[model samples]
Target: MDCHPRGRGRGRGGRGNRNEESRDVRLSKSLSYALRHGANKMGLQMNSDGFVFVEELLAHQQFRSFSLEDVERVVATNDKQRFKLCNHPEDGRLQIRANQGHSVKVTDLELRAVALDDPDYPREAVHGSYMKHWPSIRSQGISRMNRTHIHLAPGLPGEGGVISGMRQSCDLAVYIDVAKAMSDGIQFFWSENGVLLTPGDAAGMLAPCYFSQAQRLKPSPCEIELH
Candidate 1:
């Protein structure tokens, strides 16, 4: 559910063809791509809740060689808990969807709305980025870009309940003023996997005014000028 896709490890000691581990990684990435961003492009009939039939998905060219067990393995073994598998409400057919970080529109994906004073609200809401983009971010605030919502981590990586959302390689961290933003009509939602999501203001931008603090977190911790 991080902004940037995380890299997967290739299997070691493979002669020519990819090993089981390598194949699993490939299937995971493919599933992420299809479920998160390209279901429509891949010709999969995704519902408004962002779910597609597992059988239909497997029928796609990229997944033709894969079986149901392979998908179950990827979903079960994924460290980030990115995918969710369930049965269709109308019928009993199995379906799958991404937990969060969707670029394509998904109207109802089981996200819980968070209030500023609510206990479910994240104690720390941070957006991660790189130093190279700091200047632009300082001026323009945080843009959701092509994503439907801006992703935020509840806490830094390795902290409790901080499994995904922000990329580990990010050098800069922008802390958001959740109370202030909510008071001003900005909305926040919490995903099942503990990712904080915001649609931002009307223009889909979290303005600099709502940023409580900015800091360089990698190499060494250092404060950055927000004003």
Candidate 2:
């Protein structure tokens, strides 16, 4: 569930207080764990699209105590926009799912592609990684590992794409050639928030040759910064 923390506020004139931040962090972790990798064990039945009924989620042991309002707030306020709350078209019931970052074998979200005509469609993308993994990545390419798809970050003209694999220890960013990748028959899917998702090989993932550039960045050295 690509459930990374994004800065947010709790109310007018205030960022999230410690209590609110702690609560959200705990809830986000649990939700990501359950929905992305353990829905069946949790007794939450996800549809082919990875959506589970809101009622089912609320009834699940892990989240039975959380109100619908609480769930909605978490989904809406998530920085990465990882989870989505939607209305089930057929049943008209409220449903929710992790937008991407799934490891379980389920139907793909089959998200729509941003039209090339669209102003926000990205022509290039960025992926964050670490130097230590470069040898493997160069030789075998970026594999999905155990995850369902290879995630990519596509920032707007002046913005930076969200870098994965660079948190805490990663120190490199790889630039992607979106047009070239597409020309070679690689397909890319953009989530609701613009993160790119690729239907990678079931057994492996993208090959390193698809990446056009890799550069290292200095990691923060302060003890406080490391934490």
lDDT of 2 by residue, 1-227 (tens): 32333233344223356765666677788888877899988777888888888888888778866667667777878767778877767667888888777888767686776454567666777666677877777677787777776777774223564533123345666666777666666777776656687765444567666777676655542111110
- The prediction achieving the highest lDDT against the true structure is 1
Displacement of residue 101 (Cα, Å) in model 2 is: 0.9
lDDT of 1: 0.85
* TM-score, every prediction: 0.88, 0.77
For candidate 2, give the lDDT of residue 56.
Answer: 84
Which parts of model 1 are misplaced by more than 4 Å? 1-18
Lowest-sum lDDT 10-residue window in model 2: 218-227
TM-score of 2: 0.77
Best by TM-score: 1
Q: After TM-score superposition, what is the CA distance of residue 217 in candidate 2 from its true location, in Å?
A: 2.8
Give the Cα lDDT of each candidate. Answer: 0.85, 0.68
